[model samples]
Target: MKRTPLYDLHVELGGKLVDFAGWEMPVQYPLGIMGEHKQCREKAALFDVSHMGQVILRGENVGEKLEALCPQAFATLPKGKARYGFFTNEDGGIMDDLIVSNAGDHFFVVVNAALRHQDIPHMRAHLDEVEVTEIFDRALVAVQGPKAEDVVGALCPAARDLKFMETTVAPIDGVECRVSRLGYTGEDGYEISIPEDKAIEVTRALLAHEDCEPAGLGARDSLRLEAGLCLYGNDIDQSTSPIEANLAWAIQKRRKEEGGFPGAERIQRELAEGPARKLVGIKPDGRAPARQGVEVQNLQGHTIGQITSGGFGPTVGGPVAMGYVAAGHTEPGEQVNLIIRGKAQPARIVALPFVKQNYKR
Candidate 1:
């Protein structure tokens, strides 16, 4: 497995290492997953996410040329602003969800670590006119939570002025770094990209703050899940359309009218007619914790859907899950049963994002 530049630091911090998408990543620290999770919710937590893929697209009309690959209409996307989009196939299936930032001279894209091998090649094949370069000499880290702004601001005052989803090049510990007010944890935080050699130096600077603690993958997953964010392989895949995945919000209004991206026809049809199934939040009664692949059945005992991601939310103090169900059963307060351990457990459909997102807009 590939190891990130922070692997040795993770070991020194007594992180529990695990294999994640061909990378040796820290799943938890000595403080435990729940402890790290609560730390991010209540204070500030730092995460090493260097395993993710970073690609730079440079050329005239970079965003316009890249729009052919996804459903987002990047024509109106302002410079220094980032948009969340998917790399979809011809059939409207999601190849990978990515963040594309229009950074004046070039477009910066960040994709999931597991799908980098496929996503980079796919982008190159479709965006032949644009210069696509994979950046491997940089390390990415996230500082997230309510206190993150103050902590990060102390190091880089410029970051405090950045609006949500806005990005800029800022210096951290005297090392120029790309800083963005974006995160997956539904908090007001920043993702910083710096030279690999300066990763430790910058991380140490962030950790020096009394409010910041080192969080691992375990907390990251739980945080995103509680935020109602989809996990690429588990909640969404090549077989799932953006409509079914509740991602229509990412598609711009003009793009829906003048469709030019892959799967335009199918996606438009689904948008008009509605998808057969929809992803929704599920709250199981008690704390049994319905897990992924658990069959979801209606009150009448007929299977209606299955759980994609589920776990005990440390912040929520209860079991929270997100899954797909028949469109007819998607209303909040709708009752359903989850078959767990051979017993039918009562569950209810609820609005997404069990926790309120506190992004600094």
Candidate 2:
């Protein structure tokens, strides 16, 4: 497995290592998953996300060329703002979900670690006469929590003024970096991109803050799950469409009306009518956590769907999950049974985002 630039720092901090998507990543610290989860919600947590990919696209009509490839309208995004959307195949299957930022001279995209290899070629093939540079030597880190702004502000004062989903070039201890006000935790956080050689210095500076503790992928997963955010392979994939995943909101209004993106016909039809199945949040009644691949069944023992992502939510103090079920069975308050440990555990459909997001607008 590959090691990130912060591998040594993780070992020094006593991070429990695990294999994640071909990378040797820290799964948790000595504080454990629960502790890390609580710390992130109450204070600030720094995450080494150097395994993710950073790609820069440049050349003439770059915005117009990329606008056709992504679902989000990139042409209208002002300088320094970031947008989240998917690169879809002609059939509407997701190639990858990415965060794109308008970096004045060019566009900067951050893609998932697992999809980096495939995403690079896929993006390049579709973009004509565009120069794509893969900055694999760069390292990325995330500082997330309610007090994230205050903690990061002390080190990089410019970050405090950035709105959610915005990016800016800032200096950290003489190292040039791109600080973006975005994170996976549904908190007011920032993802900092720094040169490979300067990563350790910047990470140490953030950790020096009293409010910041090192968090791992384990806590990050639970945080996003509680926030009702989709996990690429689990909640969404090539087999699933954005409409079926209940991500219609990610599709802008004008794009929906114009219907030009990939799989637009099917997506538009589903939007106008309704998908056969929809992703919904489920709250289990007991301590038993409904895990992925568990069958979601109706009261009459009929299998309606399957749990895509499920686990005990530390914030909610209960077991929560998100899955797709037949449309008629997706309404809030609908009762469903999740088969866990050979028993049919009682569960109910509830409003998404089990924990409300506290993003700084």
Best by TM-score: 1
Per residue, candidate 2 scores C-alpha lDDT tens digits across 4-122 of 98999999999999999999999999888999999999999999898899999998877777878777788788999999988877777677899999999999999999999998998
Record all residue pairs in model 1 with backbone atoms less than 3 Å apart, i.e. clashing.
none
Error of 1 at 318 (Å): 0.9
Which runs of model 2 end up more than 4 angstroms from their true locations? Answer: none
What's the TM for model 1? 0.99
* Collision pairs in model 2: none
lDDT of each: 0.93, 0.90
For every candidate in turn, the CA RMSD to the true structure comes to 0.8, 1.0
The window of 10 residues in a row where model 2 has the poorest summed lDDT is 87-96
Model 2 / residue 216 / CA error / Å: 0.5
